[model samples]
Target: MEHSGFLRRWGTLSSFFLVLLLAWGRLYAQTPSTHWSDEDRISSQVIKLRNGITLNYAVQGDPNGPVIVMLHGAGDSWHSFARVLPLLPANYCVYAITLRGHGLSDHPARGYSRADFAGDILEFLDQLHIQHATLVGHSLGSFVAQKVAEQDTGHLDRLVLVGSGPGTHKAGSSEDEVTSPFAKLTDPIPYTFARDFQASTIYHPVPAWFFEMMVGEAQRVPAATWHGLGASISAGDPLEDLKKIKVPTLLLWGEKDSIFHREDQEVLLKNISHASLKAYPETGHALHWERPERFTSDLLAFIHSNGPNP
Candidate 1:
């Protein structure tokens, strides 16, 4: 009886070990391959900078095609361009970056200035060994894009500024729509704060899922980001910078955008000699979010219309 009992116990242990081994094998098989394309990859990458700060970003589309970099506004992540990523031409390689202090990127206590952000972008490109490429920036990202173009025009081919223009905002002024919406943002910011800000500012009605997604992204941002980025905008003067942008420029605005009014676009149009304005009717501050299909199509058309020579 003792011998029989020992045999049963040993058999059970052997079976358990075999099951675990099989499971491990399955998991190993399911792991992503090192040769995966950028389009198939997600923005889970962390890049360490010379300053010891880390930035996060994702890439999509053909690896050899013309590069088009997308930079999101404040309080956003690389996911901001998720909707337009797959819609881009297959012949183009797209890069979406989540600036430091936002998204999965490291949140340093300082270095959130617009110029700092632009420097980070330049370094990002340098690290990747990317030469001239088109730049598309939205809102606050537009400010950073313009800064990069002004500082080094050779790094960019064509520039697209969405919901942005010369910074006419008075420093520390609360009368401006964009600054006013986020003026009261406090540390450990709540999801509700982001929801309320988006609801009050976005001209078109965004779906519930989009609102939730945006709020989720905003909630990840640290309190320092809000204060630091805000101070950067307050201290920045982009009017002169816009005038110096020599690249072919496209300015996209929404007719109903409350944050950036018609007057702002007018000033932008007048200041940038090579810039052209395309206003979307019945749209809001988030024009791309309001009509992503149209936004993607227009972007492709513009980029291809004046694409660099092959």
Candidate 2:
């Protein structure tokens, strides 16, 4: 009887181990092997908008192919998409921009509102003579993209919003309160604070190099810019304005995202006329960082699809 019991327990343990191995294999297959060397093929450039703001950006792939304009989140530069860019096909013309008051972009004393950022993007399209392009934005950049789409510049072909919310100002939310952490930030942001902030956005493991790169990027932003951007994000509710967006929209959110809840995505879907949502399982706010390979696949599929806008 003792021998029989031991055999039964061993069989169960083996089965459990097998299940875990398979699950890990699936996750490993979906992650990109991104390295700092992957950025070597990308070229950096700067363009001065008509408003006299010089924006730094990185470009890759064929210039004549379908255009993709990527806007990074607050305190992030074009490097935010470093992993995704290398995984993209050679047929795409990707431009990842560093928004004003961040990265190497010009930092004005003011004008950090979403509308101001949208104006810069429109002017950028005009200057580059890009007739049509897909606009991709993450977090704060998503709000800016929405503002751009509202203007109906006739240049946006599609829209992709990652880690986005309907709006940043929830009446009783701790982050929106006047005494929020962002409100207390001062110049020369501490390395630990920046590291912790970046760490809080991801649930899965990323390359240590990539995480440190992101932390460095966060520290580059001035406290005043952070204050301005934070205020702009909370200043208005874009729920009604989202109705003005006529292009096909895709929202990619992480299931584990604490910053923006699932309800926020539902609110976005209800407001945007032709928007759809794809939630990533076990992922956090920085889904792309955690699952770059999967993110690229989904983005390409959306771009190639000709389904009727619903």
Candidate 3:
């Protein structure tokens, strides 16, 4: 009887392992290879900082053209701009940086603060010998961009902050707000959960393949990243930082963005002297993903505008 029970337990465990393997294989098969051919898909390399930390970044378009550095939000990688890349003119050089502790970058045990992330951007520009460039940031990235512009006004040509607000911290009680939607992901997050989370957040329908590719890239981010960086943002007061944005700034938000609402935009407009806003109807936090064409057009127009002859 003991020998029979042992055999039964082993057989059940083996069946479970086999089922998991098959499910993984099926999901992998569904994911496409188009990510490799994406116009924004430049092979990434590491930029070593003075402190020995390394940031992974992708560069595309003409080297001599106007530089535009894009920063992605928390729980996301630089691939957030994949669809927007091909839409821009070929003459514009675009650099996308994966913040430390996120994406393929080194994950240090510390240094997930907004100031730390902002400092990385400045150092990254210095290492690349880019004296100044138009800074574009989305969500958490937008908050970082504000800090960069404030660090030195002369180093910024223009600023674009999307799906961002005046304050860095969450509006409610700290204890209850510390959790993230991605808290459930395991160390090596399963692609299915990532896909479901991506689909659930957006108010509009996106192409299935696109969402798959996005979640695949996002899943590569370490689980610690979400908590570390999130805690940093939610613990600070950022109204002072918002006031420091002196460059001509463009604030873009989606009508259906649940994270940062219209009230947040109003607060930002009140704080920043040179800021203006435009809203995308029927869009959510993933405005760039939902309305790529409009995002590209509006961004280009803002970048090209002389802004009252300076």
Q: For residues 1-310, what per-residue lDDT tens digits would candidate 2 score against the true structure?
A: 9999999999999999999999998887666544445566689999999889999999998888888899988778888998799999878899999999899999887898898999998899899988568899998888888888889668888999999988647766634642256667997988987888888888988888789999999899888888888788668664788899999999999999868888889999999988999999999888888999999989888888833221
Per-residue lDDT of model 3, residues 193-249, tens digit only:
666656644787777777776788767767777667657765765587678778888
Q: Any runs in candidate 2 off by more than 4 Å, and if so which?
A: 1-37, 174-179, 307-310
How many backbone overlaps does candidate 1 show? 0
Residue 259, candidate 2: Cα error in Å is 0.8
Off by over 4 Å in 3: 1-43, 170-186, 190-193, 307-310
Candidate 2 worst ten-residue window by lDDT:
172-181
Better of 1 and 3 by TM-score: 1
Tens digit per residue, CA lDDT, model 1, 70-146: 89988888877766776677677778889999998889888888888988898888888776688999988889898
Winning candidate number (lDDT): 2
- Counting clashing residue pairs in each candidate, in order, gives 0, 0, 0
Candidate 3, residue 143: how far the Cα is off, in Å: 1.0
Sort the candidates on TM-score, descending order.
2, 1, 3
Task: Please report the TM-score between candidate 2 and the true structure.
Answer: 0.85
